[model samples]
Target: MTTSHKQAPAFRPDWAFLMRHPAHLLAFGFGSGLARKAPGTWGTLVAYPLFFLLLALGAGPLLISLLCVPLFVLGVWACQKTGDALGVHDYGGIVWDEVVAMLLVLAWAPAGWAGWLLAFALFRLFDIVKPWPIGWFDRRVHGGFGVMLDDIIAAGFALAVQALLASWLPV
Candidate 1:
């Protein structure tokens, strides 16, 4: 005689799931992760408005940059919880990593649209490509810290490239 087993349905986060828990909401980038395609890009976009909002409210680059530390800590917890629920440690929809990392990149971004655009493009490129140590960490790391660290590294890459360009270019 043989026994049959059933597989669990894949978790698809809708507004209800996102709203079900605070972690889900944050881990999903407050709904940006729900986009049908390019959720990471959408999640990264979330940082722009937030960066400007903080600026409008009197937070400077120094303060915003400092804020990334705590935000990263929070993302670790939120991503761990959300990932556990979703059963995929780095679910594509869990994009708080992008949000926090982009915030870091934007914090140091030069003061102009051109600089910000370059920063965004570079960040996305590093994140998607995950070269060398970035790819190494992404594969070896696990859990919330893992989910967060790789993106932070990508942010560092973006910052480094931006610095190089700033020094070499006139603007």
Candidate 2:
């Protein structure tokens, strides 16, 4: 008797694929999602430089917060297109959600490295753990909107914890 082996399909996206469409680039967090490990963390880190860039351009925290609205909307469209093309509704490499959500977190996070670091840690924790309603949405929701919603909820959870910590401790 002879046996045949079937190979799993590869889904590795290269720079060419990322550059093929604007939506892919955006949905992939400008290539941050291409990381071999922890693409979501890498994508979340992209928000730091972007936040500083917006600040350098004279946008305050409030303005940065406002910017997240449009960015989130754009992410929805970009992620939808990219997901459709990749045949995965919410692939691990689609990290625009993390970028947008982290941007929102930074907008409300306390000043200085310590605070920012805490915010980053908290955001990542909530995102990865996906507790309560966050898990609810992540499990039940589908498509681009669902892909983005869970991270937004995680950001909210992070911000809430940050607020409580700020009230009790000095960051």
Candidate 3:
């Protein structure tokens, strides 16, 4: 519902826009990059794994981090295409960016409740602020990697901030 940018293109939300619905959320990821045709499809498809992020991660951080690049790529593309599909830049429903960003932020974070909590807060903050390099990347770049790197950068900033906070606070 919150608009992120003023320059958002003017595409109408389509069936894939239904992916934003809460009912068929699971199915959204199945069609993230698919054409925007069905209701609640892509959003549902992408949202499940996003929901999974706070719950589980059986793999090691390095592996998961590596896995994230492609997913980040996917997120970038998803955001751009979703924007194009809906005629908006950084649409609210295109949370695939948030998904990739959150993962990237925690990719190497300490696996503690405190660390996770701090990371979540810092990540969301940095994402919203788009500070420093995050802002730089968000503004100057274009395309999939462009969409992704700003978040990736913000996540890195959050990681650094969280690490410092963790060290200083020490739960």
User: Taking the candidates one at a time, how many backbone clashes does each contain?
Assistant: 0, 0, 17
lDDT of 1 by residue, 1-171 (tens): 111112221667899998889999999999999998999999999999999999889988889989999999999999888877777778888899999999999988887888889889999999999999999999888888999999999999999998888655447
Per-prediction TM-score to the true structure, in the order listed: 0.92, 0.91, 0.68
Clashing pairs in 1: none
lDDT (tens digit, per residue) of candidate 3 on 1-171? 222344644654445564665311211244443345432233323433553563475666677778777877666656565555555455444555655667666666666667666767787778777778788777777654565677678778887887778775446
Best by TM-score: 1
Better structure of 2 and 3 per TM-score: 2
Candidate 3: count the clashes: 17
Candidate 3 TM-score, C-alpha based? 0.68
lDDT (C-alpha, whole model) for all candidates = 0.89, 0.87, 0.58
Tens-digit lDDT track of model 2 for 134-163:
999987877788889999999999999988
Please give the lDDT score at residue 65 for candidate 2. Answer: 86
| Model 3, global lDDT | 0.58
Query: Which candidate gets the maximum lDDT versus the true structure?
Result: 1
- Stretches of candidate 1 off by over 4 Å are 1-9, 167-171
